[model samples]
Target: MSAKTNEPFTEEQWLKFVQQKQLKFVECQDCHKMSVIPFAVCTTCGSRNITWKQASGQGSIYTYTITAVPPPELQAIAPYVAGVVELQEGLRINGIITGVENVNSYPADLVGKTVSIEFLELDRKSILAFRLNA
Candidate 1:
């Protein structure tokens, strides 16, 4: 997402993160707790110690759902697929899945299939998406 959103609720840092085309996650320096959300304190230990690390962007589809009737904002891109991806880093993050041509149709075997990062433009926002690793 871009920092120039007409909507005021989106965080600027998240926009910057996408603009950079880098997938990064946070880890507590004190306890090594990992999370995708950027936070000042560790969600596990409540410690202020935190560090950021780039993700490999390599993962597999842990679970997924093909939305046939998307929300109004995404009606233009309806029948899209969203999924919970399990990264090789041992973190699961929600992301869009691309390359599925048929909206009303979907793959029968997406679970455990390899995926790589692919960015797509949505609502003037740069979003992180996943696709077949090949």
Candidate 2:
């Protein structure tokens, strides 16, 4: 079943959508700009007219960095790739890059590589991630 919400979405809501496989982003009705980050007012044009739109789960890696040493809480997934992805809608969002053969030594040609949204189980909770497209 599809999910729906009236209130402005937060990180928690976004995570829920990821778990449900129904990722969504906010689009400003005034400026027509979109953002994966939830906000009560549009950041682009200061408009309150915003609507939620379904994400296509397709994007290209804008940039990335390999986290060789993560925080104490994220030690389980150390040496992970994290980066911003430019979605099909032209908006960028931050997500973990999964399906890497070797986190410690990732390929140099990762920028602009195609990726698809995915849900990963970490610490017994589902989190949003992006898988490299074949």
Candidate 3:
């Protein structure tokens, strides 16, 4: 499967795209709405026509929080930073954040910080992540 197309629209395909470090999203041709996850129909206009669009991987942190205690599956990487990043294309996606020295008492200026999409290999799978821009 190519990273450029959303053929075989499935959550697994979406994860594969993310694993490839490709920031692909489904855009509705009718309403021109974009979503990080692909759907059978556009929720905004009930349109069945959606195309995959690749993002520039550039974005700014919309908000963030330190996960001192993560879920059972992510306990191995506890005390990590995660946040919503607003992409340049006007889409917001949630991803794990990297480059923070200390999750506790992190810098207040983390919000609105520049970031780029990254992939983290964990549990034999690629997890979506973001790298703080220097």
Top TM-score prediction, candidate number: 3
Q: Which stretches of candidate 2 lie over 4 Å from their true place?
A: 1-5, 9-12, 19-21, 44-47
- Quantify all predictions' global Cα lDDT against the true fold: 0.78, 0.80, 0.84
Cα-based TM-score, every candidate: 0.80, 0.79, 0.83
> Which pairs clash inside model 1?
none
What would the per-residue lDDT of candidate 3 be over residues 49-107, giving only the tens digit for each residue? Answer: 77778888899999999988799878888889989999999999999999887667766
Candidate maximizing lDDT:
3
After the best TM-score superposition of candidate 2, give how far the Cα of residue 25 lies from its true spot, in angstroms.
Answer: 1.3
The per-candidate count of clashes, in order, stands at 0, 0, 0
Model 1 is weakest, by summed lDDT over 10 consecutive residues, at: 1-10
TM-score, candidate number 3: 0.83
